[model samples]
Target: MNDWLLAPTLQGRTLRLESLSEVHAARLLRHLDEETTRYLSRGAPADLSVESVAGYLRALNAVPNRVNWAVVTNDGDVAGRISYSEVRPADRWVEIGTMLTTPFRGTTVNPEAKLLLLERAFEVLGANRVHFKVDSRNERSLRAMAKLGAVREGTLRRYQVRPDGFARDSVMFSILAEEWPAVREGLRERVDAALR
Candidate 1:
């Protein structure tokens, strides 16, 4: 068991990813607007309280399956969340996911945040392939994944259930260890253009 897998911070200049703690649930709840919940596999409660979200984070923390982070913006507000889950330590593979808040919905934060995670996964964690799965209906996410140079391998039919109780198809994407440099460069340029 790696005790430090739960480290509390992963920061970039425009964004920061910190371990989701009780202190963050209140502000994190603020990011869970309707539009933000639409494509996500999980949804915020109708009137989610800080303590409840804290408990959720605690439960996730207890499980060895994944690590969740509160996506904090440059201004220090909780903007959303990103996680590295379904890790295969023996194979050095992992999946990346996030629930960006509504305000960050149409911004550069999403791509930039992902760039950070991808970097950590491949360069730091020495992963072989980093995977991303999006709902087939989420065109925006698909486009963003394309922008990051993820190759669409295929779709997972009826892969998971949606928040609305219907079966949702998942579009799978991946970036191999060999493709990181070019992908990273492309994302850096995209972020630069978006800021201008």
Candidate 2:
């Protein structure tokens, strides 16, 4: 099994994915709010204090199975975060998730981040499948996943309970290794167009 504990920094044309660090905590705190955390059942904690965010970053860094990264723009500003979890080396699969600041929501930050992450997962990590499980209520997220060329697998009913005690359905999507070549080309085109 690959040790995702040691995360590698992933660089792209307009953004970089660095290992989650305390330095990013303050910037991350600025983006954590009810609206940002709504669809995420295990989203950032309610406390937005710098200290709390730092502590959370520390804890995330300590985890051995999950790998997290802070998304930074080319100009050196933190934009958001992305992570690979539920990594199973034997199965060669991982789940990708993100929490982006409002400013980056409709921008290319997310698509670029996912492009880099998926490249690493499929090309470097030898992952056979890269998947996502999004809250069914989040239509935006569902559409975004589709835009990435991931096929919707199915929906898991009552898959999770939110912080607000609401039962949430999870919509699953994935891109298999066999399907990666076309997906990669599509993503590369989108990213190239965005960069232009």
Q: Report the alpha-carbon TM-score of model 2 versus the true structure.
A: 0.92
Tens-place lDDT per residue, model 2, 34-138, is: 677678756566487889878867876666568889999988878888888567788789888888877778777988898898888899888889999999989
Residue pairs with backbone atoms closer than 3 Å in model 2 (clashes): none
Query: TM-score, each model?
Result: 0.88, 0.92
Task: Report the number of clashing residue pairs per model.
Answer: 0, 0
* Stretches > 4 Å off in candidate 1: 1-4, 162-164
The window of 10 residues in a row where model 1 has the poorest summed lDDT is: 1-10
Cα RMSD of all models vs. native, in order, equals 2.3, 1.7
lDDT per residue for candidate 1 within 60-175, as digits (tens), equals 55657687878888887888878885677677888888888778876778878888888888887788999999999998889878877999999999999865788989999999
| Candidate 1 Cα deviation (angstroms), residue 96 | 0.2
Lowest summed lDDT window (length 10), candidate 2: 37-46
